[model samples]
Target: MSDIVGELARVAGAFDQPTLTLLYRGHAKVVIAMLRSAFTRDNRTISAARLHAQVDTYLDQLRIDGFTDLPSGSGRDLCLRWMRGQWLVRSVADDGAEVYTLTSHAQDALNLVTNLTRERASLSEHRIATIVNAVRRFNTEVNPDRGARVDILNSEIARLTRERDRLLQGADLTRPSADYMLEGYGELLQLVAALPSDFARVQEAFTALRTQILGSFRAEDRHAGEVIDDYLRRTDSLMTATAEGRAFEGAFTLLRDDELLLQLREDLSALLSHPMAEDILNDVDRRDLRGTVGLIRRGIDAVLAQRNRVTATLREYIQTHNTVRDRELDNTLRQLDAELARWMTSAGPRTTVALPLLPARLDVHHLRERFHNPDDDAGPPPLRDVTTQRPDGLTLADLLAQGGPSLDQLRAAVHEALASDEPLASLGRLFDALDAPLRRPVEIFGLLHLTTNMDDFVRDKEHTEVYRTLRPDGTRRDLAVPVITPGPQSPDSPVTFAEEPRGRAPRLEPA
Candidate 1:
């Protein structure tokens, strides 16, 4: 073999099988080199063949059989597969080789070691803090036995001094010069008394006693603290228990004080499930609270109904009353119209009817003469000098002495007189004073004209004629005047006959 192979084989032979396997598996190259160096020291050179044989034997003994150049299906390959499935220490063989080194089991062991280290560190910190707090608490208390011993020493010293003074006083008179021992004792006593007062020593006694009492109290306080802590612990336990569905102490007390309402509700629910109780509640007529309530409701309804009725009656009465008043007012208005019509007829232009109802408030002679004869050119038809004539001397011829007017002049006069405000009674007298042949006065007092049948006319009254003009074939024609007598006409009495051939005739009695 070559020197390099001899050197590497010798280096690999001295390594442990695990180190050799790790080298072969390509792990911790520096550690593998260091392991190889132990075997490869200058003076310790083993021959390459011997080194290979030893390494091979070690590998077999350790069952580290995978470090080889094996093809598929070789025993070495099988060993490698087994090693791959397990966690075993690994190293190199007698010759250099390469693969990944760590086994699963070795990795797990390292991780476990790391975790244990971390836990040990954490536990160290906790224990250190616990010891610190305990020491701090311990330093604050006095030593009770030491303080009591100091107090007892101080009291014994004071008692011995008093006894010495008393003994010295009693024996001094017997041997004055022989009292040196007493003097010396007194001197020592003085010197000892002169020593600084151990106030701390005295105070230590009270402090110790106080500390004892306080310690007792503190121990009690610890019990109280334990009690409080226990109470808190119990409270937490109760809360946890309740959360986990366990009953806690005093749990029912809460229900009794405040949560009793839940019980009441449950009871009420149970009551509703009972048929008799449910029926009783359902049968209660809440609508009928009291008779007074019903009565008041009924009374209010009645009052409203009465008010509506009264209002309706008042409205009807008012309407009816208004209708009656309106009808009466209408009747009064009709009567007024009729009376007005009568008064107008009496006051308007009058024809020469015989009985004139004059406005008796005026005289006749002072009336204006408005007529003029068109043919004769005479002054207004001569006014009747009847002002001087005796009322008995006026005959028809005397009345006719007044000059008359022509038809046209009379028409003018009638129209003028009608147009004026002259009363109807005056117009009648003026017509009587006229001497026109056709225009003559006729009696008209108490005339009763029948517009219906003659059977309805009243008797024993004078009558007059009324004329009407007509148009026949577009020519002006005079119609026969209607003769109205005051009495009912006999069916055969003077049946007058006049046709259109006779011209319009007056259906009047001869004057």
Candidate 2:
């Protein structure tokens, strides 16, 4: 169970150092936006000069935004800082200009940041229905041997189909409450946020494979040819046989189908235009829903493309090694021929000249027997570390104190009340922190309930909380708190308000 929990944790962990810094470090968002913009449309590689210009333009805008202390060359410095953190990879371009690409780490970091900043979303029956149906379709196409899918389909098909018919007929189609609609929107957005992370995770796997291949080539004890052969074999199995790989490949295949794209676009248009949805769907939500399927498909394509890029690298390595070996074999043969000619000239013709066969390069498919890194605790498609970021702030306490309290008045009251030398403090202290009108019967009860829940509050028979009130005549009267224990087994009756005649205040009693 511990191992399972650790595995799940490892899968979710994708935020790297650059991602963490970008969130809190000033101007980091501008720098990231610049990078994203540079690559967003068509370009994957950005030249130093062009990127610098883009960053400088961004910084200039920052200055116009009234940020005066923005340092000079900070844009370039920021880019380099990302490089140092392994967020960006720099290499010389064909024209000798330095070019940069977002490393898998950088992509993962960006995805992580986006997910982190996303608004809290709720899952709902409608969203769950749509998502589950899509997943079921995927499972049928990708993993047909699974047992429960068909059963689920049989169970939901009639109900869902009838609902769709009613929606199309515009007959008795009622709009869901705002809360329900908002929840559905949030659930959809959460899935959208998660899709990019999945892409980044796959990209990271491709990177890990590339790293392994490079490591194998550089290792002193292993033959490079054998290492590569084994690497290729393992890679194929990883892509085809592993669960993560299968999910990605299934998604890739599904998305790559032109028919599916067309159908998805149509379905989204139809769903959004439906009379039932019209009330709930706003322009932004509609646009997002319309584009979400396409965006997800694009992300999956990018991830698969990363795998192809890594495989291409492996092919290049193999081709280079083969070419080099062929050259060396030719040289060895020519030297042998020279020796044979010399022997013939000195001691007459010999019956035969012996030749040694060159050591063979292993076949690509059968290279599974090569050395794997000893440190790896091999699992499905064996991978290495997930991303981790060094948190900001000077100490653990500082790090923990990351956000503001929910209510300022309540916060101050709780703090000072907790610090008081008195074992028992008046609940009115909290109510006094706010307007008298704000401290209604419900509010006073809420404050009393909060004190009982806090560990700092000492509760005993002697500490039966009492409230003091000063009258217009300057005499004091006491009021008794009905409940003292934390969330009660039987909550008190609801307070009812009654209309009062002319000048008297409204009376309240439990109903």
TM-score, every prediction = 0.10, 0.47
* Residue range 1-511, candidate 1, lDDT tens digits: 5699888887777453432344345333332322233232121233434434543444454345454432234333433543564422233333554322333233333333323432122234334555775664454344357766667567668987987888888855333232332232223223222111121122123323333433443244343345345434533443233321132123323434434645545654553454343223332111211122233234334333433443354334333434456568879999999987877776756633355587557656777678775777755676677766668666776564343423445544544443445433332243444444424322111011111122322222244433322121233222223332224344355422221122222243323
Best by TM-score: 2
lDDT of 1 at 182: 29
Question: Model 2: runs farther than 4 Å from truth?
Answer: 1-18, 24-47, 68-72, 90-154, 157-171, 193-197, 221-228, 238-246, 272-301, 322-511
Candidate 1 lDDT (Cα, 0 to 1)? 0.38
lDDT of 2 at 45: 74
- Report the C-alpha displacement of residue 280, candidate 1, in angstroms: 92
How much lDDT does each candidate structure score?
A: 0.38, 0.61
